[model samples]
Target chain A: MIDLPHSDGGHLSLTVKVWRQDDADSPGAFQTYKIDDINPEMSFLEMLDCLNEQLIQEDKEPIAFDHDCREGICGTCGVMINGMAHGPLPNTTTCQLRMRQFKNGDTLVLEPWRAKGFPIVRDLVCDRSAFDRIQQAGGYISVGVGSAPDANSVAVPKKIADAAMNSAACIGCGACVASCKNAAAHLFTAAKVSHLSLLPQGSAERKDRARKMVAQMDEEGFGACSNTNECQAACPANIKVTDIARLNREYAYASLGTSD
Target chain B: MGALRRLLMSSIGKKYVMGLSGLLLIGFVATHLAGNLLIFSGSEAYNTYAAKLHDLGALLYLAEAGLLALFVVHVLYAYWLVAENRASRGDEGYEIGYRSKQRTTYLNLAPRSWMAISGTIVLGFLIWHLIDMRFGLRDNVDPTFERYVDEGLQSEDGRPLFLRYERAIQILQTPVSFVLYAVGSILLGFHLSHGASSWFRSVGLETHGLGGPLKKLGVILAVVIGLGFASIPIYVWVAGVEVGDLSAAEARERARHVSEQALNQPVEAMTAEDVAPAGSPDSDAGD
Candidate 1:
């Protein structure tokens, strides 16, 4: 006898079209899976789990996808659903997208994030390590944690604090990369610049931060921001293009005398 | 140095040129639109207005020279900025994200950045306009003196001038021109919709105390300018004047003759000679 409950459910049936790839550079195809008797309260990722469970019962190979920190903070779970990053909910991450948002008999299309710099790993999984490389290029402050002066030493204005907080909200999601026509990473780089450059802690390395981040962004094969502002719309974090503009200003100033 | 370096090396300079030249061009558009609106007053009034501008002589020459310089600088600086931006990003593409949460709550909900796309379309329409009206139609100037002359104007000599109002009427009467004008006008409206607001923001005129009112004013100005400019071609086409059937070459020859007649007329006859020059050297002098 099947241990799974047949129906605790309000009626919801969904058809999911998921991309399946064995490895990077490998050919990929879409596989259809039917999910039935889903609860309205369950999250969209939960719905995927239900499908995966059914597939496992049949001894079929389970689909591979990325997710961690089911809450929205990690930026780990990003997938394009029906041509939109993070599904239909504006500024809501994939894990936060609840099945209650959809009606019965809905069809969901899922695919890995698309960008020249972000290659697919397997199935719906993609290698987002490019963002890491770019971050490492100089996303952080140079000051050692304990080596820094007293926090009260620098008197940062309230407006700067608010702006820095805004920039600090970026979660490093690659939705911006997937949505952009040019696949520009300006939004991401901008967030990094704004967060650090706005804070007193990050003042010493401000110029280097802008220069290194932009250089790393270019090296990663991302495109330039055309000021389309689409990425600003798709971001779950709701990061602004103003941050990008600030980044541009910082980069401009840095390039004047910097050797690199 | 490369184009990128050249542009960056003179970033502030380019911005000054863009801002100044852009303001000057805006003034020209305003004056040009005001003059064209007189067409609604019947052919005689409009024609006289055209003749007046022609009689300005030295003043008119100065205005044209200023407009030409503004146009050249604006185009050059625009191209330079675009090229430098592209180079800075290099081959790698930039990522853009929609900050739907923040924008909806914190910032103005309107997708104002979409104006760039609208501006590009308007630019294409402007090119078509130059070709059709300025070059192909040769409607703006009387062929006689090479001075800018409005069609349907009388020669300062009091001789009955053969204006190309017939051609203007016929061109406007065509379904193609009417449709083109309508579509172009809509694009222009969209371009101006965001442009007026952006211009204020660029110049640091959008302060918290005045930003809201300024934006509202910008919208009103955009709508007025867009509709006003767009209405000219539309009104001419719809007026249904009985244009005698003239071949394209015949039309050109006739326009040329009318232009010569208007140009040779004495400086005293044109009302434009009486007015002060349209622009001030002191305005753009800061750049």
Candidate 2:
């Protein structure tokens, strides 16, 4: 007998219309899955896990989805729930989304990020290596870590340090890509460029970072920023488009005659 | 250089090109509006202003050519950006997210979606405007600046005395032309209101603190300039002011009124004859 616990909150019944793709090249379709007796406090991924367990018992193909560090910190878990990246709740990730937010008999449609730059790997999983390549292009500084410097020695101003940390909060989830009409990676690129570029250690490579990261982003077939601002709206980390302005300023200065 | 080309090919670089070109076109429009506002001043002042521009000879043509080039760059790049944005959306759209009627705040949160439509209508109006006035295709009256200068305040055999002023009033009085001008100006207003500051933001020039003020300035400028152009056809049609029939005294009175209203600067009363000739030392002297 399966144990079912009914907590303070009532159990939720959900109908999920989820995209099912065997591989990147295979034709994909949506498969409907009905789940019942799910605790309202269960996270969105937990509900998915319950569905997968039932599928395993029935001797059918379980849904394939990506998740790591069920907490929101890792940025590994993301899916478009009802056409919104990480569901309708703003500034919340999929792993953090509780089932209580939805009512009974609510139908949810889930899909992977659908930008040309992000190729679908399997059901609910797209190859996000494009973002990694953009990061590797020039998202960091080449400062040689000879010896550990005292934290008080290279003291950054509180304001700049705060901005840097804020930008550093980007989890590299492709929500911005999924939400953008143009699928522009400007917000994501701006985050990485602004994060390290705001610090003293990252300042030395500021120009090169903006130029190279932006170039890589464009090369990856990402679209340009049309000022729609949906990326900022959908951002789970609440990263502002102000970083984009800073990136633009840095790029303009770099485009002029170079120092070396 | 390859670097410049590469920069232009980049998305942000293309935005800089659009921003710079848009600003250049706005400057030309401002100058054009100021000059056109002279129509309210009566024949002598209007014709004199038109004639002086003609006297610039090759300089005037150079400026015109530069303006045309700027227009081409702005329009072509705007089309490119729209096409690129379309391709980025992939094969399908969201089934539920970002519903059209949903309101995010008190102010409408949706970015103005009709910018491309408004821009295209304005572009079409521009071509029609050139065909109507510059080519003199409508009434077969010569609208050339040199011709206006030659016939200033002088009655030709069986023709209007104030050639340039008469032609302007006649064109403004036409119903079709008036409606087209009115609609075009409104569309242009919509285009400019969003575009002026948006270009800056797209290029990353607009900072957080300055965004609100910059947007306000853009909308204000758009309304002022759009209404300013639209007013010419409306005032002409309503007042039924005969440009060629005004006597010298009436002309002087109107010129003073135009200076006070349009320029917002009071000037000493001066007859048409009192005005210094073009290229005179006082006229050429830099302020």
Candidate 3:
């Protein structure tokens, strides 16, 4: 047999089962496609681009997915890869995932975030405006409109600052909701709530923020936290479930009519 | 009062209720298991405990009402929450299990996910337990046990003590009740494995250092409770070799049969010759 350049382990064949839906009202199902001679060095999104190109040449409707920045930062790229949020790697975004991680002849299943709070927009895109609404409900600290205060004006302990920053690392990608069995958004809401509340700047309305955001989250039809911690496992930011515990404390205080 | 209503109605509030009520139920189950363990202590002890409970009269009725209210609230709230949670994932769930799974379609195969199924089994077991043990329905419990009467074996209030033990043995000895109770106890353990520890997290009692250890402890408690209750029916089946609480001759016969069983012989088929005749080949020589 004649030797081909594919002998370098640079090529792989894969079967992809991707969810396809035209619009919000349409029912979706997994459509399987076989791709050959893939470059393993390609990012997962680039592999998808190859699949779309192949589909175009085959006179079929190409798959629809969302991506921006082609990096892990934007949080624009996300889908359930074999039911895992942001593919199989821990602390990874879909755009940052390389095709080399998967083996040849492996089958991968992809789907949009499945939750009432993040309804499907198309093939692999879902509406995450519920997060925006929750943020609007309270997830912000109000500041007086003037020249910014000096950086050292408010004394924040180094440890507390680090904690706040850690909580603030959440990208609001909706993976936590997709990964949750209950489709609960507790992680996303809790991250924001914790990020603000841990800092003194957010103490003025900390309790109020917790109550309002949680109420909005409930109104969005997201389910309650069952303390499963699948959201913690699935988060790309590696946010802890302790943030959720903190939110619980804040809400309790607020409901008990604590004036701060 | 208005705040209370809203707290009970909100998502976190509803979770608080579920966890609080669930912990309360766990308490009741532990107490019940403790009481049930007195069965091994013989008629006088078990009956004395039962009589003490009965003597409470008005206090017992009041406690029972509270238990019933808690049960009703816990069950109804659970069903409603399940429905609500199921809907939150939209009409369709994930078509495949995640990376660690073997391509199964069910999205979650974790122990916590199966809580409802285990809970349902526990409910069935509870009803059966009440019917056979508490109410002593003639159809459900073997009425044959009522005939195993003895003289002068009465509680402080003259309630027949031997009949209670015999009645329990009669009921638990059957294949149906045995399977029901045994399976129910195991499944209840499975349910509590998740529910017991999760209540801590739900009510905000879980902390970083304590959460992991708390989980292991909860599972251990759950498993122990399960095995403890199941042991009773197993004891009945073992002690049931003779007619439970019967003539002394039958007890002697049972002891002889047990000794023969240790030799692995069919008790009836074993003539004296079959059991190591001097000239016969030693079948158990190596052992």
DockQ scores for all predicted structures? 0.12, 0.30, 0.29
CAPRI-style docking class of model 1 based on DockQ: incorrect
- Deviation in angstroms for A248 in model 1? 3.5
Model 3 lDDT tens row, A80-125: 8877888777778898878877888888899998999888899999
Compared with the true structure, what per-residue lDDT tens digits does model 2 show for residues B180-265? 89888878877888777777776778876787798899989899888988888888877877545544544434433433333333
Model 1, B1-287: lDDT tens digits are 45356334343334435555666776777787788787677544555566557567689889878877876776666666566544433342212232332233233234354544565676677777667655554454224322223332345454434343553455566677778777787677666555555444333243334545765776787788789977877776666555465543343344334344345332223345322244633223223
Q: lDDT (CA) for every model shown?
A: 0.66, 0.76, 0.78
Ranking by TM-score: 3, 2, 1
Could you tell which candidate, 2 or 3, scores higher by TM-score?
3
Docking tier of model 3: it is acceptable
Best by lDDT: 3
Docking class of 2: acceptable
TM-score of each model's chain B: 0.64, 0.74, 0.75
After superposing candidate 3 on the true structure, give the runs of residues whose Cα lies further than 4 Å from its correct spot: A1-8, A143-153, A258-260, B98-109, B138-140, B144-163, B241-287
Worst 10 residues of 1 chain B by lDDT: B92-101
**Worst 10 contiguous positions by lDDT, candidate 2 chain B:** B153-162
What tens digits encode model 2's per-residue C-alpha lDDT throughout A1-260? 11222344778788999899899889888889898898888999999999999889989798888899988888988988877788767788899988877877778898888888888899999899999999999987686745779768888889888999999999999899988877889899999998988898888888888888989988998887766566777788988888887877777766765731
Give the CA lDDT, 0 to 100, for residue B189 in model 1. Answer: 65
Give each model a TM-score.
0.70, 0.80, 0.85
